[model samples]
Target: MSDAMTLREITDFAENLARKAGELVRREREDNTLRTDYKHQTELVTHADVMADEFITGAIRKRFPAHRILSEETMPDLSQAEELDTPLWIIDPIDGTVNYAYGHPQVAVSIAYAEKGQVQAGVVHAPFSDETYRATKGEGATLNDKPIQHSGATEPRQSLFATGFPYTKDKLEPLINRLNAMIHQCRDLRRIGSAALDICWVACGRLDI
Candidate 1:
């Protein structure tokens, strides 16, 4: 296949898979069927996470059997991801588990396609909002199929920053110091639980920093 066709195919697959996973998670949450657990006794995990991860990885395997998968729930081992001669898929089935448990609308399903250890395409799907953000390498990003770009704010005081906290709080001194600095320098800060959605928000000009 041509390079353009390959990129388009992979990107479409990622976007579709993300949407499907997002729907699954949303439905599970709405139906009150989520079984929650803790990973490393800190990070939250749910049965929805495992189900979505399996669905995405299984679809990728069927479509591109040779591709390597590094999913947050199932195949998180990254020892082999350092050197990527083949296509790789990175997936986060439910990025904001805590928020999802709390009925927050910040949950998302994130998927990325990488080749040669470089991400070539990505998609982030927010089920609650029914919004999908997508991008391909060498092309601009989009939100809900509309092109998006970052806000052209040059001054820090005019920008709105989004950040997340680590699951473990043992070494929060540095993070606190950074937050303190940003609070003073920037207009304001938002603590969005979903890192994937935070990044998409920045790309779509919703958040400047």
Candidate 2:
């Protein structure tokens, strides 16, 4: 690995693992009986989430064992600088677990890589839509490899910044109030229960500003 941080390597790694995760989702979605439980409050946990996280994280470990994995379902300790010497992968398996739990097609897998504490790359895969979005720092962004642009409102008042109901009490009420303000400011508001997909849509300008 060179200082350049090859875009191809990161892109391919994320895309491949994302596709694998998607397949797992598809399998369970088709089966229609994937076991699920609550992780916290109303947040969900499923075997699919477990399987998908394992699949994606396992692939990363196999390809780059030295890299640290920080995911929604699993935690890996990397308190030392040397531990994060190479890369850090942040992942959310089955990002829209609530949707997936009910056979909704809005679920997705999100993978982001931080190189030295900065988001060097991001990949969002919506298997149900067959749409994939990827972004690399200083290299531009793309949807399904075609160039994509951001259409988010330059002004916070006019912007439709999406958020989720916080799983923790510390931010729950604040998040709701923030969302209410955004709804009033924006042309309209929408909540999809998936933060990754919301961020991706914001990146592509599909949602209102």
Candidate 3:
């Protein structure tokens, strides 16, 4: 992959990769034999996650071998990684593993491209809904290839907010504090299981935060 590749090129690549991973996730959901295990306190990981991660990493390595990959299931040691100057591909193959394990349809696959620590392109695919959201630097975001813009609602009373808690026990207090501040102010609050989908929702105006 040449460094001269345009942002549109990278964005298209990330979108396709996310769709591929999302298809794998959807197929695994149907198998009903997901082997799930805990990574930390409440952080869930399923066989599907590993499988999708491998599929994504293998494709990226084959197409853009020089790019550094940081994936949820296979993260390189930051201490051993080179400086942030190199192009980096960040991936979340099964963004809602718990929801996926439970047959919920909120799960998604997320892929982003970053250079010098700045994200230049990203794609989030929700296979169950067949929704694909994509964005490229200097370009507006899109949902299913249609341009999307944030909701213009400015009043808290009229907005719908979204939030999620971390798996760590110690972070509860801060999360609660933040939640307390926003819950009453918004029309209602949603706690969707997937961070990547939460962001996509926000970008598409489905959620305010």
Candidate 4:
């Protein structure tokens, strides 16, 4: 809990917490009875999301009791948003709630810490594959405790780009326009349905450009 904890210590702690959350998600991945509901007409959530968020928040509060936690399902007040100026945790316990609801193995537990507008650390865990990606400000990134690198290849032919499916709405036409552009520029684009997984794949060189 000490602010004096080294980066290595923070990474180790975050790694452990990420794995714990992943384990929870993996269990949910196999459960076909997860009750789901729509957060909006497009966005969704499941029992898994609730449980995972609770687990991640508990871990953060236990260690850095004074640190701020910003979760997707529950957010702090905008008036008190400055509390994030200190050690803060941004947690998306289940990044692909829609995928998880449909029994797709494309969800993840993501926790990133920021201090003073800079990302201090990030840990993303995919329980289905036991693939865990960790990154620190300058210490580089890793997967399953091994060093990982980005796919450096930028050629569209050899590169595989990933993105989200376009959301439908009367007022969000601009996002559809931008997404359509990317879909055309890449030889192939996949919607993994999980942002954490998408970024982790980019970090581990599994996907590129």
Q: State each model's CA lDDT, in order.
A: 0.87, 0.79, 0.86, 0.79
Cα distance off (Å), candidate 2, residue 4:
9.2
Clashes of each: 0, 0, 0, 0
- What overall lDDT, based on C-alpha atoms, would model 4 receive against the true structure? 0.79
Per residue, candidate 4 scores C-alpha lDDT tens digits across 35-93 of 77767667777777888889888878988888878897568664554445567778898
Question: Residue 59 in candidate 3 has what lDDT?
Answer: 94
lDDT of 2 by residue, 1-209 (tens): 42454866787778888987998898888988699888665667889998899888888888787887899756767565344667788899889888888888888999988866667788889988888888877888888999977784677666655656655577577667776666777666677778888878877887644
Candidate 2 stretches greater than 4 Å from native? 2-5, 77-83, 155-161, 168-171
TM-score result, candidate 3: 0.92
Per-residue C-alpha lDDT of model 1 across residues 74-126, encoded as one tens digit per residue: 57456657585667788999888899988999989999988767788999999
Best by TM-score: 1
Residue 188, model 4: lDDT of: 79
When sorted by lDDT, best at the front, the candidate numbers are 1, 3, 2, 4
Better of 2 and 3 by lDDT: 3
- lDDT (Cα) of model 2: 0.79
lDDT value, residue 174 of candidate 1: 99
